[model samples]
Target: MDSKTPYKANLIKQQKVCERNFHKLMKLLPDLENNDNLVLSFYLAGWEGQARFQVLERAPYTTVLHVNLDAAWGQWLKLPEFRIRIYRDVRMAEIISVNKDRHFKAIYPYPNEKMLMPDEKEQLNQLFSEWLNFCLTHGLNN
Candidate 1:
């Protein structure tokens, strides 16, 4: 066995973990059939700021969710980034006058609100684990 091989295997394992997390989230959401008005954004990062994947979706009466595997936290913590944005009053005449860009900006700011907050780093790790299970079982993606 080669020394470098072990490092390569570890990298692959991490990649798999990220992929599984992404798929698990997607699978939890309801499938879109017709209309096309919803939008989704996903950012994939590894280590510091290495981006690996980006996905977007658009459909009516749909929910958009972003799932990210935050590798920066390391083993001491498991940090998963989650975001949900809902658009409303699109079909109304008066609401149609609203600025599209500005509305989107207001809903999705640079920083998002957290659904799960823990008192400590260790607690945060536990929260992430619980979140993964809850999102998977409760179908919170949509």
Candidate 2:
């Protein structure tokens, strides 16, 4: 097998994930043009949480959105937060920033100063997918 085979495979998988999450985000962003901010609440199945979405930048073919966990409970919880750049024409959404840091590499050297994992990029995208899935499945627009 070629050395690049694994990387190519991962890239393909990540693209699928991003594309799927884009559709999910679109579902959650209904009536998007009228409002800049939207919040969704989830309380069913003994789970309680909220997700806040804001449009940071809008363009003809691309949009940047900031998403975060909105905790009505308290401030002690560490929320999962990220900024997504959606390519409308391509139908893809990707995480540009996460955990308050704006820069992330596709791969990182282990035991580095920041301690980011090697697959940080893929992890962040996967995380965005999970969050989108959870919110769409459990959330109610508010």
Candidate 3:
């Protein structure tokens, strides 16, 4: 087998994961379809090494949720990741990341939050659910 075979397979796996999660988000928040600012790209861009999903914030004046993949699949270290940022009237209020070292950090505007690590499906679901509610409460989805 060629060395690139594994790498290619890893990439494909990562893409599938991202795609599944993207669909999950869509299922969770049907309102996402109404937001023109929302961009769902399950696959990596031509120049991007990571696949990501982004959501724009309403109250924060221009925030965005940037969900990124830390590394290719099959890598010894690396996992799904994300972050929140601000842009021109397009910011994401919450910040989150799953690092290559398996450290997961999520900062939210709300209290009583927990730190989530990669491969933790329950935690990940909670995180997304909270974010969806956060956006709804902040009037982003309206």
Highest lDDT model number = 2
RMSD of each: 17.3, 3.2, 16.4
lDDT of 1 by residue, 1-142 (tens): 4434321223343334444443443444334223223233222342332111122344464334333443444467744453332232221100111112112211222123632211222232234335555444432121
Candidate 3 per-residue C-alpha lDDT over 16-112 given as tens digits, one digit per residue, 9 for 90 to 100: 4444444445553455435534433222223213334556454435434555543344277554465543332321222234343233332222222
Candidate 2 lDDT over 53-108, as tens digits, reads: 89999999988998888764536767778899989999999999987787777777
Global local distance difference test of model 2: 0.82
TM-score of 3: 0.27
Model 3 C-alpha RMSD vs. true structure (Å) is 16.4
Candidate 2 vs candidate 3, TM-score winner: 2
lDDT of all the models against the reference?
A: 0.32, 0.82, 0.40
**In candidate 1, which residue pairs clash?**
37-59, 38-58, 38-59
Cα misplacement distance, residue 58 of candidate 1 (Å): 7.9
Query: Which candidate should be chosen as best, given TM-score against the real structure?
Result: 2
Candidates in order, TM-scores: namely 0.28, 0.85, 0.27
